[model samples]
Target: MEGSCKMKRRLLMFTLVICSFFIAGVVSADEDILLQQLIEETPTGGILELEDKTYTGNIAISKPITIIGKEGTSIEGGGTGNVIEIRSDGVTLDTLAISGSGMSRSSQEEHSGVRVMANDAILTNLTITNSFHGIFLNKSKNTRMSNITVVGHGANQLGTQGNGIHIMRSSENYIDNSYLEKTRDGIYVEYSHNNFIDNNTMTDTRYGLHYMYSNYNSFKENNFIKNVGGAAIMHSDHIHLEDNKFSFNQGSRSFGLLIQTSRDIHVLNNEFHLNQRGLYLEQSTSNRIEGNDFFQNEIGIELWTSSTSHVFIKNHFNKNKVHALTVGGESNNDWFENGVGNYWNMPLLDLNQDGIGDDPLEYSSSLSELVEENELAYLFLASPAITIYEKANDLLTQHKVMAFDKYPIMSERKPINVASVGVGIILAGVGVYVYRRRALR
Candidate 1:
């Protein structure tokens, strides 16, 4: 019995020894594997903690993983293909700098620092440079990209360099607190919707923000400064732009904001300064433009005739060479709504001590001179020379009236609005709202 027991104990000891050897061999093999090979071997939902070293090679991740890079850790592509290709959902990448993707002349082969084909990915604090595209998302959704800095090749040539953050057919993404410069477009979204882009600074790009065929999006508190073109919203609708600063975006063809073929847009409390045109609306309809500051622009607002049902109220049009102009549209726009109109830097009188003007202000055109010297033309009779010049010019030129602001405010509406003083007080609520929004952000 004692001998049999000893033999069984030896067999148990032999099994344990083999198990120990197998575990030690697995650990050593894992330590010897390269990062690329390690990623390939890791299963789904693994967390990879990278050391502070450079990993050179193109890495493709097809499983959900959290890659946490230590400071000074980088992934370089060696100038070929995409640096990191993510094909799985719920991937999180943080604290890494990626660069050196191959530049291709063809748009189809455009190389990117990171290409995301997954949903619900989070990319934070990444620095991307020297690539065709900084980050490209294809059919991604619910992605959170924040604190990312992208420096492109500084090429504004179309189809050569891609956007800083490009979203194609993605929706419900949150991109905030990011900076992008020197790319084709800073943030370009196509066929994307329900996205929130807030507090982003984009400069020196072709378009600071460009959207096409996207709708129901809101971009607020963004600074689009010193760009070739500020922003272009084309073929979209139901967009809300609030409290944005469009500054120093000046060129002959460039403007602070361009709205084309869009409808139901709300542009409120925005600061448009030092641009060629503050607001250019082409074929856009039913837009409400209120409480905006249009200062130092060559043209404050230009409304093309294709735009209809526009409501311009309580906006300050000051120090612009041309406060407002309209072309090729019937004067069917509501210049004044709810007895409140815009504040113009024109000669106005409120002799009755009321804050509002006594006479209905006329946004005069060359066609106003066509009103002949008769009892019906009583307003022009106050200035006989003006009336005579209008009559003579009308007889000579025969130009028709374009637009009229019948209730122009007599005083400049303060950015801080006071809703009710006597009659037609500009609402100070919007100013307070704007101030609070900026402060909270």
Candidate 2:
């Protein structure tokens, strides 16, 4: 019996020793340390904690680590330096406020707040302000950025150069829910392909979103407001723009949306207001434009030379000062909604009272075309020469005068409010009962 008890005691001691070793291993494995030491001691897939403090020096991350910043943490680069440089793949930066990065403009790509040259990296919920080239991604594929806000104050204290978010030679990336303001260009995608930019807000920038040689990219649900040159696309193909709002982009040469030297693009369900030109299509062909709203613009839609075979359907052109449709070149093959045209907001007398105008709406005429080219020609709109020009066009080319449904529905189709209707019916029944009772009394 004593020998059995001794054996049991030995087994318990061995188990306790093994457990102590396991506990020691776990405690060592889950140790949290400083940023530099954590980077050094951490394995490939470890977490690096950046505490809520101002980090001044530049830090180069060479390994695949997740740099998690504490909430309300600010990482301020003094000047002419990058706060976080990601050189390895699988890097993620979240909830960091990076600011004060601007340097001398030696090269076109000189200063940046965060320079990421790694693949499969993500930057989210980061605010970078007063910096040149905030969040520059070069040759990085499959990089995703969301909820990033970049503000370039263009303060006199620092040299002003570069863009807010510049993606060069990067492909298969996504940028969404971002806000950019007061930068050279809010989001510039150059030489990239197959990217997606959606749900972003860009204002007070030179150009809200500029895409050059970037093909097959989709932009949707973005708001470009008060930009100098809003949303220019050049030398790209198969681009799709949908449900974007371009408003208050007022400049002499600026446009709400510009498509140049592109082909096979589709623009649909967009709204443009108070811009110099609502939609400008130049040096492009075989594009589809449908269900767009152009209101209160100087020139609603302009198709300059080299634009051809574009389709326009179900578009609303209302309250435009000059021309609803300004067509140049010999481009035909454009389609309207069921042979019905856009709303011109002009007086077309219903002489026959058949719910259609007796005379067709003149979308393109000599006077309207001249007013589109020269903004000063709008002064002569009330002159007798304008009427003479319209009359001549109506007599010669009656095809220019297109007719749309006079009282077209302007509201979107929404679901019925059943609860409200039920309540209204109940209230009406109660009122009728009270009225009958009062009458009987």
Look at candidate 2 and tell me the lDDT of residue 384.
63
Model 2: per-residue Cα lDDT over 158-230, one tens digit each: 2366688999999999999999988888999999999999999999888899999999999999999998767
Q: Which regions in candidate 2 have their CA more than 4 angstroms from the true location?
A: 1-38, 154-159, 325-340, 346-361, 365-441
After TM-score superposition, the amount by which residue 216's alpha carbon in candidate 2 deviates from its true location, in angstroms, is 0.4
Off by over 4 Å in 1: 1-33, 41-43, 107-109, 155-159, 351-354, 364-403, 412-441
The RMSD of every model to the true structure, in order and in angstroms, is 11.0, 8.5
Which 10-residue window in model 1 sums to the lowest lDDT?
A: 367-376
